[model samples]
Target chain A: MMNPTAAMLVIGDEILSGRTQDTNTHHLAGALTGHGIDLKEVRVVPDDTGAIIAAVQYLSDHYDHVCTSGGIGPTHDDITADAVAAAFGTPIDVRDDARALLMAHYEQAGVEMNEARLRMARIPDGAELIENPISAAPGFTLKNVHVMAGVPMIFQAMVASLLPTLSGGKPLLSRTLRLMQPEGVIAKPLAALAAEFPDLSFGSYPFYSNGTYGTNIVGRGTEASELDAAMARLAALFPMDGT
Target chain B: MMNPTAAMLVIGDEILSGRTQDTNTHHLAGALTGHGIDLKEVRVVPDDTGAIIAAVQYLSDHYDHVCTSGGIGPTHDDITADAVAAAFGTPIDVRDDARALLMAHYEQAGVEMNEARLRMARIPDGAELIENPISAAPGFTLKNVHVMAGVPMIFQAMVASLLPTLSGGKPLLSRTLRLMQPEGVIAKPLAALAAEFPDLSFGSYPFYSNGTYGTNIVGRGTEASELDAAMARLAALFPMDGT
Candidate 1:
């Protein structure tokens, strides 16, 4: 059986402009991996409605799940919800349940539910709300696509709420072996070991820091024992003390 | 006049797996912005050849320039060069110039240039090499797509070499106002201020730190004095102490 695949769409001009470094994709990747869902692709697009709509439609059709972050705020640039609705060919209006959640939260905090804040209540037809514990404005799931807030905290909260509801496959197990040798020297033996175990995936990541250069060989597989055996062979092939 | 647009394609399973946080995109974003190139989109795909080819082809076609980072190492998983060749309908092989560069560097460092190491010499047809000062493995530019090493330091060096060759437009200027008021409270007046300046783009980023919530309004434009005027209006409309 194949593992569930997911594609992430990050919608923010801040990220593309280099004003904001996105930590949300990394966070989602780790969490989704833990749940055995393969995050196949991630795209960061501008705050444009046409781009959002095209990306949402394409990713939703290709993958089992499509997760999106950003552009769901109470601002002029926050047009993700509307774009998503258009992608699904559905009409959206201020849904009462979502409005009640925002209204109650604001009422409790002694804040007014103004027009901008009320914009959060607009939900597309036939969508389920993903609860937001961090803030009252909820994210929603239209079919397989999950739309959440851009802020890291709110995005995380929505993911936490959304993950348990989806089906997952066996979690991918991984082990890394760090070598003092540069990638060129280590590449030959590593390829041999990789050929020996065709089922497992081996990745070599090179790093140069503080005048020390090395490669981290990562072995990933679904089976723990097989993964361990591969790491053992890798360690023996390029022993730390030998290099 | 519109700025020259660019798209970044980050190729690596490590990024998609959440094992590594991609710092290359952020670095490129800032550098490109400074050079007056608008980084419109960023896509992170796994080390799959077909995916890489598709992305490279699409991005190369859509934008003026497409910058790619990762998968330019001497490993079995390093297939970016081959994928890029296939995308452009060109054959790839070990070119004499690239091989000479790697051979010289390895010989100077007293390292053996094995078959695996020689893999770095493979360049697509009709491509120009992007010099790598950190490592000997040269990144190449085929048409508008600039392929570079995934390692941060090496990626930075290749970008430094490539940026000077590209045509750049006016640098984007920005001014930010940090307000203690929450985004909900400030959205109305902010929209009015945005309407007043059609040329400038306004972005409101909400933050929650140390149990305090506030919004940062960033005004961006090519015109310096126009950006300042918009910011001044924003400050007057929402005085910090008033809220």
Candidate 2:
């Protein structure tokens, strides 16, 4: 079988509106890669249920694992818990395991746990809680999808909780050839070299400047040896001085 | 009717692999906002045609416009142009307009336009070119979507060309109040205020610090008056040093 693939669905209208710069998706992408899971796709949608359900269904079925971040807060806008339940066609009620943890957390912190605060206790059926060390309210893993918080610290902590449980594939490996040559000059030769290594993925990201010159050609693959060999070949073709 | 909404599909495995930070989406989101157009979603998919087609279909039907960046380069892995054609179910033969432009570009640059280069000239049917001022081979606008170069400079320029032609809504008005209060602290009251003005969209982005304290509460709305009133209320409640 092919390597295990993962996709992250970041749900929050705040991100698209430019009201918030999403850091959780970036964090999860890097964190998952370290655990040897190949992150294939990432999508950011609004808080709307229709968008959330569609993304959840698509990502879950297509990839080996799926992760969702945001919308797990206490306010009315924090509707991911309910939406996730609906996406799976499961009923969402207060989850006892989550409620106990949250209650204890609020009690120890001397904060009043209201009905809205209790909203964080709601979880979909047949899911296990992904512990949140930073905060008491936990993220959950349902089927292959792990749903986490949007807050950076909480999200990172929750992701950390889930990372240990994941059985990953050959970790993605890459090498960057920071060449002083323009993409146009090296495009044909690089394309020929890329065809030789179908297992590896080669990308040329061009950076143009009047004073300084060059583009960063990045080669990526699940195998370390392939990436190392490609880097060696890349160096031979395009030297530092653009020869 | 509401202003036309656009979604950006960023095609690259580099982004999901966490080797490269995707900056194009942020640039597009900001530019779309300035044009008074709503950016509905942003998805980063791998260079897989199936993934690209699925994302394209979902966003195309749901949003008025869909823009894509990356994967249109000379490399074999650069399959965005072809995948986009497949997505629309259009037979993507080389069009005269793009070929003429690309041929002129290659002649001026004194380079042989190879088969890989020609792939860029093959856009989806009925697509008009979005001007790329930095580079000659232009990005195309298929229906509402404008596909542009992955490189930041060319992407920005392409967006600039198309922004003028887009019918804009009342410029999205935004005012932010940053305080050192935890989001949960202000969540209840602020949510109530936001609900009172249902037209406005309120976002709370929380930040933590070893020495510093507070979250930045941003309020945005389509109407200037509503924004002003909300801003005034926020200022009054939070004050300059309320936190």
Candidate 3:
């Protein structure tokens, strides 16, 4: 069975400007893959409303699921909630449940529930909130789109909270044959093997490490036997195993 | 003057599969920011030809420049050259200059000039070669799009070679004020200050470190004085110097 395809929409100026290295995308990618969700595409756009809305709408329409990270904070730049609301043409207001969650957390910590903090409680009508354990700010799910925090810790937590709710297919299995032979020498047989096993995907990664040049040929598929067969063929063609 | 905008197209299944962490985007983002080029968007697509062609065309038509990473290798999955050629309605063939470069490098190193290796010499019509000092496989530039290898070292080198060939605007200047206050407490005043300075861009990043929570307020603008004024207002509004 084909896994449900998902797309990640990362919105932040800090990432685009190179002020911050985005780890959320990487974290989500790995987690989604492990959970048997196929991540087909990832797009990173700055914290602009039009861009956010466009990306959200496009991804939500195309993919089975859309995960958005960043621009959901108390600051002026945090416009993700509004953009998402606009994308779905949904009315947004401070939902009582989200507000209560924030209020309780803040009260326990003895922090002031300022207007800026309350902004985190704003949710589009009919959207379900995703829990955030690291901070009081809650991510929400509207239709197929999941809006989460940009911070790696919170984004990861939200992902953990959200993945279990979604249906996942069989996880893709991959096998690697690490050979000391250079890609230039191995590319011919690798291409032939790839053509023979059309269903399986093949990737050759060249590495120069410890004064040795080599390639790691990865074969990935849902079927373990097919992957094993492909790996066996790869090993036979390559002959030598350096790794 | 406004900077030339660029969008990155990352072509690989490894990234989408969560098998590899793509550092090339972060590297290119920082490099483009330094070169005064506005990296407006980044899209990661799989190794599929149709997807690659679509992304390349979209990014090339939308942005002033397009930088594509990955799939330019000797293996069968390395179809970036063909996909890019199709995107531009151009024919691709093994060009003499590119073949000569690879041949010379191989001959110097006593490696065979195999058929798979020769595939790296394929260049799209009306394209210029971008030198890769790390490896003999050269990347090419078609129209405004610069296609490069996926390996971080080689990608960085190709970007370094390509940036100097393009025109650059004034680099954006940024100033940061670090305060030990929650973003919830700072968002309202920061938003007001952001409105007061329409030309500058402000970003607030919350961090929890050493059992303390704080926010880093960054102000960015092309004009140094405007940024300085915005920083001044931010500092006064926050009234903390915990940088």
**Which stretches of candidate 2 lie above 4 Å from their native place?**
A209-213, A239-243, B91-119, B209-213, B234-243
Ordered by TM-score, highest first, the candidates read: 3, 1, 2
Judging by DockQ against the true structure, name the best candidate.
3
For candidate 3 chain A, the 10 contiguous residues with the lowest summed lDDT are A234-243
lDDT of 2 by residue, B50-97 (tens): 988888888889888888988777666778877777878877777889
Model 3 CA deviation exceeding 4 Å by range: none
Q: Supply the global lDDT for candidate 3.
A: 0.91
Candidate 3 residue-wise lDDT, A119-189, digit = tens: 89999999999999988789999999999999888898999999999999988888888899899888988
Candidate achieving higher TM-score, 1 or 2: 1
User: What value does the lDDT take at residue B32 in candidate 3?
Assistant: 87
* Displacement of the residue B177 alpha carbon in candidate 1, Å: 0.6
Looking only at chain B, model 1 earns a TM-score of 0.96
Pairs clashing within candidate 3: none
> Could you give the DockQ of candidate 1?
0.84
Least lDDT summed over 10 consecutive residues: which range in candidate 1 chain A?
A234-243
Tens digit of per-residue lDDT, candidate 3, span B122-196: 999889999998787899999999999999999999998989999988787788899998898889888999899
User: Higher TM-score: candidate 1 or 3?
Assistant: 3
